[model samples]
Target chain A: MGLSHQSIINMQPDVQLVAVCDSTRFVLDMLEKYTGVRVYNNLSKMLQSEDLDAVIIATPSKFHGPMVRECLEHNLHVFCEKPYCLDVTEGERLAELAKQKGLVNQVGYHYRFVGAFQEVKRLLDIGAIGDVAHIKAEAYGPVVLRPSGSSWRNQRSEGGGCLYDYAAHPLNLVNWYFGMPESVGGTVMNKIFSADSEDEIYATLRFGSGLSGQLSVNWSDESYRRMTTKISISGTRGRIYADRQECQVYLRDGGNLPDGYLSGWNVRYTTELTPEVWAYVRGEEYSAQLDYFVQRIKAKEMDNINSFTSALQTDRLMRMLIDDSEREPIAASGDYQPLAKGNSSWWQRLTNAS
Target chain B: MDKVLFGDNQFFGVNHMSEEKARAQSMRFRDTQAMIDVLDMAYEAGIKTFMCTTHERIGEVCDYFRKHADRYPDYRFYPGMPYAHKYANAVTDHGIVGAIKRFLPNDGLMDAVVRGGSAVAKKEIDGIATLLIDAEMKMFEGLSTPVIFLQNVVTDFLLGLGMKDAFRVFADHVKTRYNAEPGFFSMNMPRLLDVLEEVGVENPIICSNINKIGFRMCGGVDLYQQILAQRQFRPVAMSVLASGAIPPREAIEYVCQLPKIESIVFGASSRGNIRQTKALIDEFMAVRQD
Candidate 1:
C-alpha cells in the first residue's frame, strides 16, 4: 500500500513526498533513494521537523490512535490506514479529537474509492435493487499459507487478525452503505493460520429494519492472491454484485439504469465503471483516494467519505461482533416463540412457509 | 445410545425438497427456545439421543444439556461435523480467515491456534483435520457425545474425490481423541459401506436415506436392503419420511422391518409429531422383537 501511495503521489504535482519515517533504515534508505524524499528515524522528530500540509500514516494498527492523535495535535490533515486502532474506545476518542481540532481526517479504506463499488452505491441510492434484504460480503485470498510465520498481522495484541486486517475493508464498505448496524453476531475469530490471530471471520449482522448481512473473510484460501472481496446484495427487486474490478447488477424493469444496461443482469468491467482519471496506477482506487484526501485538505473540508467518525463506527461494529461471538453460549435466546403449530396439513404448511 | 435419535434439520432450515418448507421450519425455530421446546418434547417422549448436524444452534442445545445435566441425565448428542452450509456461509462472510474463526476453540484456544499455525506451516493434513474436529467438539464439553458423525456433504465429496483415507482418519480420531464412536452419513449407503469397510473402519455406524418409497435412497434400495441384511455394520435410517412425503406410520414400519437396522433419525417441530412417530416406532419394534 505504501508503494502504491508512492506511485499515486508521483503523479500528483500538488502532493509532495516530503519525508518518510521508519525504524528500519535499510528499507527507509531504499525508499528515500527511490522517491528522493528525506527520511526520519522517529515519528515524533519527523512531525516536529517536516513542513507538511498532511501526513499519511502507514504504521502498525496498534499505534494508529496515538499517531492520529499526534497528527491532529500538529494540525495536519491525516490519512491513516484501514484500521484506525485495535479497539473501539480509542477510535471514538481519536474521531472526537479530529472533530474538535477542525482538521481533515481520513482512514485508508481504499475499497470505497473503487469504481465498481462506487457504481454499486450509486445504483443503491437510486433504489436500483430496492430494499436490500441481506448482503453477503466475502473476501478470500492465499495471503497466509504456512503455520509458522511471525508478523504483527498474525498477533491479536497488535490488532492483527483476519477480522481487522482483511475483513476491515468489506466491513468499511458495508458501513458505507448501511451505517451502524443494530446488532452484530456470529463468530469472527477462528484460526486457520498458526498465527496468534485468526485467519478467518464469519459474522451475521442485523441492520436497520429487516436488513440482514453476512460477513465472511478468509486469508488461507490457496486459490486467490492478496484478496478478492465480493459483495452480493439480495434485495426485494433484484441483486447487486461487486468485486474489486468488476460488477454485476441484476435489477427489475423499473430501475433508472442509463444507456446499454437493461433491466436484467448487466455485466460491467472496470473500464466502463471507472471515472476518467488524471493519473492511473495499478488500480485507480489508490490514485483516487489519495487525490480525494489531498483535495479535501486543500479545500479545508472537514467532511469526507472515509472520515474519522465513519471509521470509528466500523471499528465499533467490528469490536461489538467479536465481543458478542466470544460471549458464553446461551442456553436460550428467550425471543418470542410461535403460538402453536396447527395440524401438519398441506394448507397449513403453505401458510407457515410464507 | 437410543434407538430413535432426533435429527436437527428441523431446527435449522434444511428441507431437501421444498424451500418453502425449509424456510417455514427455519422461521418456526428461529428462537433457540423454540428448538428447546421441540427437543424437550422429544426427550419427554423417550427419544433420548439426538443425531444432529453440528450447526451453530446445536452448540446452544449442547449448552442446555450440559447446564441441566441432572435434569436430562440420559440425553446424548450424536454430533455430525462439517455442517456444510455453515462452512459455506462462513467462507462467504469471513472468507477463509473468518471461516477458520467460526471453528475457533473457546478453551485451549491458544494451543489450537499454535497447532493450527504450525499445521499450516507444516502442511500436516491430519493435524489440521483433527484441529477442526476439536473445534467442532468444543461445544459438547462436559456433555454426552457418544457418537460423532461426519456430515454427508463432506463424506460424499471426499468419497467422490477418492479421499477414502479421510474416513479412516476421522474414525480413528473420534475413537482415540474423543473416546467416542465415529459415524458417517452418505448419500449412497452401499458405496459408503464398501469404502468404510475397505478403510478398515470395521462395524462402523453409518446413516443414510432408507425408506420403502426409495426417497433419496441412493445406490439402489435393494442394494441397501441386501447390505442391511448381510453386512455387519450399524445402520441408522434417515430421510425415512422422504421430507414428509410418506406418512409417519409407513416410514416407521418399513425401517423397523428392515434387517439389521440399528436406529432411525428424523426431525419434527411439534409434540404430536414427535409422539406420533415414537408410538409407531415402539409398536413396530415390539412386533419385530416378538
Candidate 2:
C-alpha cells in the first residue's frame, strides 16, 4: 500500500516524495537505492527530519491509531489506509482531534472511487431504484488458501484478518450508501483456513425505516483469483446489482426512471462510466482517491469524501459485528426432544417390515 | 505481431464480467493437459502466437513446448512480464530480499544477485528494473519470444509515476538483452502513446481494450478513436469482445475498421469459439483490406 502511495505521489505534479519510512531494512534499502528517496526506520525521525504538508500512513491496522494521532499532533494532514482503526473509541477520538485541529483527514476506502460503484451511488441518490428495501454486500478472495505462518494479516490483533482486510471494502461501500445501520444481528465469524482469526464473516444489519442488508465475506475462497466485492440492492420499484466491472439495474413499469435509463434492465460498464484520470495504476480508483486527497489538502477543505468521520462509521459497524458475533446463541428454556430421536424406533420397525 | 493471438485469461479464472464463469473456467482448466489441449486447438487453427502471462502454471506450458518441440514448429509466445500476483504472493511468503532471490534466474544467480546489490548501491533504477525483467523472462528462455510485453499493471504504474525514463530503460534492455521488440500493455493507450513517443520508442506495439463498448478503455471511445486515427503506434487490440459483452461480429468489425490495429488477442476455452472468432477476424480483416 505504501508503494502504491509512493508511486502516485511521484506522479502527482504538485507532490514530491521526499522520504519513506518502513521497518523492513530491505524495503528501505531498495527504495532509497533505486528511487533515491531518503529512507528511515523510525517514524519520529522521519517526521522531525522532513518538512511535509501531509503524511500517508499505509501501515498495519494496530499502528494506525498511534501513527495517525502522532501525525495529527504534528498538525499535518493525514491519508491513512482503510480499516482506519481497530478500536472504535480511538477512531472516534482521532476523528474529533483531526476535526478540532482543522487538518484534512481521509481514509483509503477506494471502492468509493470505482466508477461502477459511484454510478450506483448516483442512481440511488436520484432514487432510480426507489426506496431500497434490502441490500446484499459480498466480498470473496483467495488470500489464505491454507494455514500459514503468522503474519500481521492473519493475526487478529494486527491486521484484523479477513473481517478487516477483505470485508471492510464492501462494508465501507455499504456505509457509504446507507450512512449507518441501526443495529446488527446474526453475525458469524467463521474460520476456514487461518487459525488465529476468522476467514469468513456473515452478518445481518438493520438500517433506518426497516431497510435491512446482509454482509457476506470470505477470504479463503480459492475460486477467485483476487478479491471480488459486489453489492445488490432490491427496492420496491427496482433492483440494482453492481460489482467492480459493471452495474445492472432493473426498474419496474410505471416508475420514475432517470434519463438514459428505461423502465427495464439497464447495464453500464466501467469503461464508459469511468472518466479518464491524469494517471493510472492498477485501477483509476486508486490514483483518483489519492488525487482527491491531495486536492483537498491543497484547498484546505475539511469536509470531503471518505473523511475520518466516514471511516469511523465503518469502524463502529465492524465493532458492532464483533460484539454481535460474540453474543451467546439463544438456548431452549424447556426440555425439547428431536423428532428424529423420538421417532427412531418407529422408523426402525418400518424398515424391518420393509 | 500476429494478426490474432491467443490469450490465457480463461485458463486462469480472470473473467472481468462474471465471477461465476471465471470460476467454472478455472475449474475446467485446473490440469496442465486441459490447457495444453486448448493451446493445441489454437495452434491447429492457424493462430500461432500465444500471448500469455508468466504465471507459474505457464512454466509447465513452456516445458511441454520444449519437450515436444516437433509438435509446435512455428509456435511463438508473447509473454507479459512480472505477473503482479506472483510477486505479491512471493513478497508475502518471503520478504523483499528473499522474494528477489527466489525469482532470479538460476543460471546467473550469483551474478544477478550481485548486480541487484550493486544496482541498489549505484542508485541505478534501470539496472534493478532490468534485473526483475530478466527474472520474469526466465520461463521463456530458449523459446521464441519475438515481442516481450510489460504487463499493464506495471506499465501503467510506471506511467502513473511519470517515469518516462523507465520506459526507455525497458525498451533498451529488451532490445539489447533478449533481441526482442518491447510491447506495452496499458489501460490508457493515448497517454501511454504520448509517453512512449517522449521516450523515443518508435512505432511501438501497444495492447489495450478496444471493443465496441470501450470496456476498460481509458479516455473513452472517442479519445481512443481519435488517437488510433492520428497516432503512429502499432495498436494490438485486447478485450475486443469486452468480456463477451459485445457480440463477436460487432466486436471484430469495430476493431477491424480501426485505422492502426496490428493484432487482436482473444481467449476461448473451446475449439468452436476459437474457430469462430478466428474466422470472424479473418473475414473482417480481408473485407477491410479490400
Candidate 3:
C-alpha cells in the first residue's frame, strides 16, 4: 500500500495524494513524512475530514466489502485489492453501486496489466489462437510450508485459502477473457500445509461451448521463487504458455504475426514493454495498474476491463467453483468398478444421464 | 508398493486439465504395445512396482506381465479399484446387467450375484460392496497386487455419505478374499483416516495427493505432516509434482526429505521423463538413506 502511494506520487502528478490513513499511527506518520500529506488513523475520519477524490482499499480481504461500500457511498472512485470481497453478494452489490454512481472502480488484479498478458489479450482478440478450446491456469509458489501456517491466511473466513487469495490472480485473468464458465468441478487439497484452508486446488471448468479449463494453484511447495502464475491457452490453431515476465506462442498457423515468423514457437518477453520505473516495490505492474486506475478516473471511464463487474464475475466464479467442487468433483481417472454400478433400468439410467 | 511406483496416468488419458493433452495421450497410447514399451523402460530403469488403476486397458498390461513373469520376477502391481470412468463407460456401452456380468469373476457367478442381491435385499451394504471388489480384482487375479487401494471417487463419496463402516467391509474382504492388505486413496485423507479409525483400521496404508504443495492432500498439509509425525497411517504420496507445477529435483528432494512417506507414485510417457524422475528420486532417496 505504501509502495502504491509512492507510485501515485511518483508517476501521476495529476492525481495528488491528499492524505493517507492507517490503523497504526506509526504507519500514518511515516506516510505523512514521506508524502508530506495529512494523515489519519481512521478511514472514516479521513473520509469525513478530507475532500478526497478517491480511496484505495488495500486492507485485508475481510475489510474490502465494507470499505468499498463506504467509498462508493461517498462517490469516490475506488481501487480495491483482489478477493474483491470476502462474500460474492457483497461484491455484486459494490459493483452495482459503483455502476450506479459512475465511479471508476477497479480490482487490483495486476496480472491483467502485465505486458505479456496484455499481448496475449491482443493475440487472442485477433483470433491468433483461433477458437479457444481449453485454458490451464496455474499459479504455484512457496507461500506457506509449515504445518501450522501463518495466522489469518489459514483461516478460511479471513484469507479464503489458496482458492480465494492465490488463485484470484489467474482466475481474474481467465475471467477477463472467458467470462464465467458453464460449469465447474474439482477439489481443493490441503496436502501438506496445516492450514484450515487448502494449499492446493485442482479444478476443472467446462464452458457451455465445450471449452474445457483447469485451474491448479499450490502455495505449499518450496519449489517456486514465489508465486509465479502461468496460464496455458490451447486453441484450434496453436498454444500459448505465458507467465508474468514472458509469453511463448506456438503458432500452428502463423496468421497473426508478420511474414517469416513462421508456423513455430516464438517467444515474447514482457520486459521490453514494461516501462522503466524508479518507485513501487513490486515491479512495473503495480505502477501500471495504479496509473491505469487513475487514468480511468480522470477519463470518467466507468467500464474498464478490470472494472467492478469483472472482479465481481471472478468472485462469483470462485463461489461457483467452491460449490461445484463439493457436489461434483472431477476426480483423477483410474479403473475400478463402482460398487453401486448397482441397479438402474437402462431407460431410467439413460434418461437420468442425459 | 515400491519406494517409487510407476503409475498408469499416461496410458489412461487423464491429463489433469487439458482435453487436448489427454486426447493426444489417448492417441499415443492407443496401441497396447505403446504402454508395454513404457513399462519395459521402467523395468529396465529398476522400477519394479507398477502402481496402477484397474482401467480395462490394464488387462492387457496384466497379460504382458503374465507373459514376462519369468523375466521380471520382482515386478508387481499395486492396484486401485473402482476407476469410476471404467464403470461409467461400461454402463454406457453394456448397461448395468451386462456390465456386472462382464465384471463378475469367472470362479463365482451365481454366488457373487446372490451376495450382491442379498446385500441389496438385506440392506447389508457389505455384500454388494465385496461382490464389486471381487469383480474389480478379477483382472489382476494371478498378478501380484500387494496393496489394493480403494479409489478416491468412491472413498470420498462414501466418506461424504457417512458410510464409514463400508470401508471396514472393503478392508475385511480385501484381506480375506484376495489375501491382500487393503489400502485407500482419498481426496480427503485425514477425514478418511478418522473414518478408518472409527471402523477399526489401525495404522492403515493410504495413497493420496501429497507434495511440497498440498496439491490434493485432504485436510491441510500441516495436518498431514503432523499425522505423519505422529505415526498414524502409512502415506504414499501421489501428485508429488503437484501435476507438474514443481521442478523435478526440488519436488523429489522436498518430499523425500519428509518423514514417513512410504512411497512416491508418478507417471511418465517418455523414457526421458521416466529416467529423469527416477534419477531425481534415487538421488534424494540415497541422500535420505545416508
Candidate 4:
C-alpha cells in the first residue's frame, strides 16, 4: 500500500491524499504514518470532505463497487483495482454511470501497461505467428491460497475466490492481446482448497478471425509463487508461443534477428513490479493507468463509464461460470485438438456430441 | 508504368453517421476521404494506378473520380474487398462450428470447433455473405466503374481451411451463378496456385497481397518474408513502405534495390506526403535508368 500509494501520490502531487480507508485499519494507519495523511474509518466522511481531485480504489473485491460508486457520484475520476467489481452487472452499471456522467474511469488491466505484452501485440500485428490458426493459454499458480480459516476471499460474498479473483489477471490480458471471443464456455473445478469460489476454470474462446483458443487457470499448487501463463498461437507462416507473464515470444524460425530477439525476455519479462511501474508512472511510452484517467479528463475523453463495457464482458462470463450448477473438470493438458469437422447442430450436437 | 496505386483502410463512411455531431466529425475526421483527396493530389503529382479497399461509399467515391476522369483517364483504380469481415459474418451466421463442419468433411474437426468458442458465430457468417453479396452487386451494377474486386484472400476462410479444391468448386459455382469476374485481388500465392490448378482458373488477375505478413490462419513474420522472396507469385506490391512506416526516400531506395519488384503502391494521407512520394518516385526511376 505504501509503494502503490507513493506512486500515485508522486504522479498527482497537486492532489492531496486526504484520507486512507480500509476495513483493516492497519494498512490505513500505515499509509497515514508514512505519508502523514489523515486516516478515516469511513469512506463516506472521506468523500464528503477533503476537496479531492480523484480517488484511487485499492480495496478488496466487495468494497470495490460501492466505493467506486460513492467516488463517482461525487464526480471523482476513478482508477480502481482489477475485477473492478465481483460480477459484470455491477461493473457494467458503474461503467455506464461513469460514462453517462462523463467521468474518466480506468480498470487495472496492468498487463497492458507492461512493455513485454505491448511487444507481443506489435509482433502479432506484424504477423509474428503467421495467420494465428489457434492459441492455447494456461495460467497456473496458488496466489489465492489461504490457511484453513475464515477469510473474506474464500467466501463468495467477499468476491474472494479463484475464478473471480485470481483468474481476472489472465482473462484481462487475454482480452487485451486478442479481442473478446465470439462465445465462451468453461469448466470450473474446486479441488485445491475447497472454498465457495472455484479453484480451477478451463475456458475456451473463439475470435472473429476463426482462430480458437483454450485457457486453463488452476489455484492448486505447492510451488514458490510460480505463475506460468503461456499462449501458443499457430498461423500459416509459423507458430508463436508467448510466456505471458514474462512477455517472451518464442518463434518457430529466426527473423531479421534471432528467435526471441524482439525484447524483454526471461526474468526481466516476468518481473511485474517496481522500476517498470515507476517508468509507467513517469510516462515513457508505458501506461500510467492513473494518468490515463487524468489525460482523458483533460482531453474531454471521459464522457461515459460505458467506455469500459467491452473490458467488463469477461467479468460477466466469470460470474456466469460461478453461478453455473454443473461443474466439469478438465484434465490439465496444454495440448489442443483442432476440430476435424464443423458444428451443424445445437441440441443434437450437445446430445450426440460424442 | 501507366498506373499508380493508392491503398486506404477504413471502418465506416461519413454517410453512415446519422447524428449531426457525428456527421460533422465524419467530414472533419474521415480517414478515407482524407486519403482520397491525397490520392487525387498524387494524380496531379503524376500518379495513375490507384488501389483501395472496398467501402460502403462505393457510389460516392466512383462518382467523385468519374467526374474528374478526364483529368485521370489513364488511372486504374482497384477497390479490394474486406474478406475478414465476410469470414467474421459467416462464422457468426452459420454457427462457426456448423460452417466448418459443412465445409470440412471430417467429423472430429466438427466436435473441436463446436467446443471451441472461437469459431465464428452463425450471425457473423451470414453478415459476411450478405456484405459480400452487397459488394458484389455494387460491383456488377458498376456503382464504381469497372469495380475492381481486390480479392481479399488474406483473411477470408473461403480460401484458407486448406480448401483449394472446395474454393475451385465454390469459384465455379460463383461464376456460373453470378456471371462476373470475381477472382481478382491479392491472395496467398501457394493456396491460389493450388486452387487455380485444381479449378483450371486461368483468368489473369492482379495480385494485391504485398507488405502484409502471414496468411489468415498461420505463421510468423519471418516465414512471410521468406515466402515473399521464394514464392513464384508476382503481385502488384501494395504497402511498399511496409504500412508507411519506412520514409519515402528509404522505401524508394529499397524498392529500387529489389529485383522483379514491378510497381509500387503509394499511400499518402496528405497532399504534402503525396508530393514527397512523387519526388521519391522521380528519384527512384532516375536511379533505376542510370
- Write model 1 residue lDDT over B1-290, tens digit each, in one string: 57788988877766644434566887788788899989899999999998877777778878788888899978888999976655654553444544665565546667787877765455455666788898788788898889999987677655643457778889999999889999988766777788899989999899888887664555467777898888899989888886665778887898899887788898888899889998888888777842
Residue B67 lDDT in candidate 2: 91
Cα displacement (Å) at residue A207, model 3: 0.5
Residue B97, model 3: Cα distance from true site in angstroms: 69
lDDT of 1 at B31: 87
Which 10 successive residues of model 1 chain B have the least lDDT summed?
A: B89-98
lDDT for each residue of candidate 3 in A70-109, tens digit (9 for 90 to 100): 8889889998888788787877888888988899988889
TM-score of chain A, all candidates? 0.90, 0.93, 0.87, 0.76
- Candidates sorted on lDDT, descending: 2, 1, 3, 4
Residue A130 CA error for candidate 1 (Å)? Answer: 1.6
- Model 4: runs farther than 4 Å from truth? A1-3, A6-15, A144-147, A224-228, A244-246, A250-287, A298-300, A303-307, A323-354, B1-290
Which ranges in model 1 have alpha carbons more than 4 Å from their true place?
A: A33-35, A254-260, A330-354, B1-290
| Runs with alpha carbons beyond 4 Å of true place in candidate 3 | A1-11, A33-35, A253-260, A275-280, A328-354, B1-290
Instruction: List pairs with backbone clashes in candidate 2.
Output: none
Overall local distance difference test of candidate 4: 0.54
Predicted complexes: DockQ each = 0.01, 0.36, 0.01, 0.01
Chain B TM-scores across candidates: 0.92, 0.95, 0.92, 0.59
Better of 1 and 4 by TM-score: 1
> How many residue pairs clash per model?
24, 0, 13, 64
Each prediction's fraction of true contacts recovered: 0.00, 0.34, 0.00, 0.00
Instruction: Report the C-alpha displacement of residue B248, candidate 2, in angstroms.
Output: 5.1
The alpha-carbon RMSD values of the candidates against the true structure, listed in the order shown, are 20.6, 5.5, 21.0, 27.7
